[model samples]
Target: MMKLYKKYQSLIKISFFIIIFLISNNCNSQNKYEILKSKIENISQNSTDNSKSSIEIIEFLSYMCHHCTAIENILNQWQSSIPADVILIKIPICSNKKSEVLQKLYLTINEINKPYLHCELFHMFAKEKKSITHIKDLNDWLISKNINVKEFLELYNSFYIQSKSNRANQLAKLCRIKGIPTFVVGGKYTTSPAIAGDEYECTINTINYLIEKIRKE
Candidate 1:
């Protein structure tokens, strides 16, 4: 009888430890991101669409902002592994003439189906320290890239590109985006590296956490 009681006690002790371990692990998993509530703000309290399952993550950025250039690699890597339900939209903030030109340039490249040039343009400004202050400067750079300068110039000056650039500017204003590299998740919550104590990883974690939060809702 004593032997049976000892075995029963041992099993109970083992089960208790297992339960404790699981509870600890669950708590850790819930708080793994250490997301700071202050780092994110609610932009919209409106109800999200129940019919659409996908989420849109809009990134407001500008080529003139070095901070935006710095996070491109990490952002691109994260983009590559994103789930199919998430969509990343990059919008250039046109706060001035130079930025307006860059915004048009981005639209022209997309219209021409040469989206790869987007990274090349960033490399030119970030690494080469090049500036396209005038149409001539942009033409010269396009020529060096072996792109059809005449074709690019035509599209760059087209009304379609102008309209797209204008829309981007308006969207930035609507979002009240005051800084580059600002991320708006699901068009409702806004966060950034600056908001997350200038920590890129924290910003990413915040983004992922928000994504899951929206999914659950």
Candidate 2:
């Protein structure tokens, strides 16, 4: 009886060690972003577009959110490296005035197709330490950028900007976004680099993982 009990104990210990070893090895193969991707991809499926043909990357963000401001560089770099086939999207938050300002800023620059100017807006506001509380500030900044002040204002106050702002707010609600810098992959799942398993790395990894998963599907 004693010999049999010893054999059972040895077997249990070996099994436990084997399980631990496998998990450790797997962890070694994984990155933080990969973990976030795995969490989402495990529950992935086809939805809106009806075939799961492409991966949807939505950066749900607000300019007023300092953390989002900080991570903008990372997103910018990640976006540049991504291929053209991926459906990249940005939803500017519009829950309040600050968010509203940011969204309007987005549409205004987009309206003119001045992407370079669009890219500089955030740096102007966050890095240069400028206060963007009113139209004058934005107007002055645009003028400084050599953007036609009158034309910009005409669009700024136009019904188009208002409609776009409302749409942004509605889209945000639909996505269930309550914070800045939240990201949703494929519209079925949402997370933040801060709240997700990994911060910015999660965003990049989610893109990579979904790219692989979609290719497989």
Candidate with best lDDT: 1
Give all TM-scores, in the order shown.
0.75, 0.70
Count residue pairs with overlapping backbones in model 1: 0
Model 2 C-alpha lDDT per residue in residues 1-217, reported as the tens digit of each score: 9999999999999999999897554433134222232222211233554334556677777566677777787888888887655666676767667657768887788779887764566676677776677888887888788988998889988998888778767666766666768776664555566554435555566556656655665
lDDT of 1 at 84: 74
> Model-by-model lDDT, in order?
0.77, 0.67
Q: Across residues 131-152, which tens digit of lDDT does each residue of candidate 1 receive?
A: 7889899888888889999888
Candidate 1: deviation at residue 98, Å? 1.4
Q: Give the best candidate by TM-score.
A: 1
* Total clashing pairs in model 2: 1
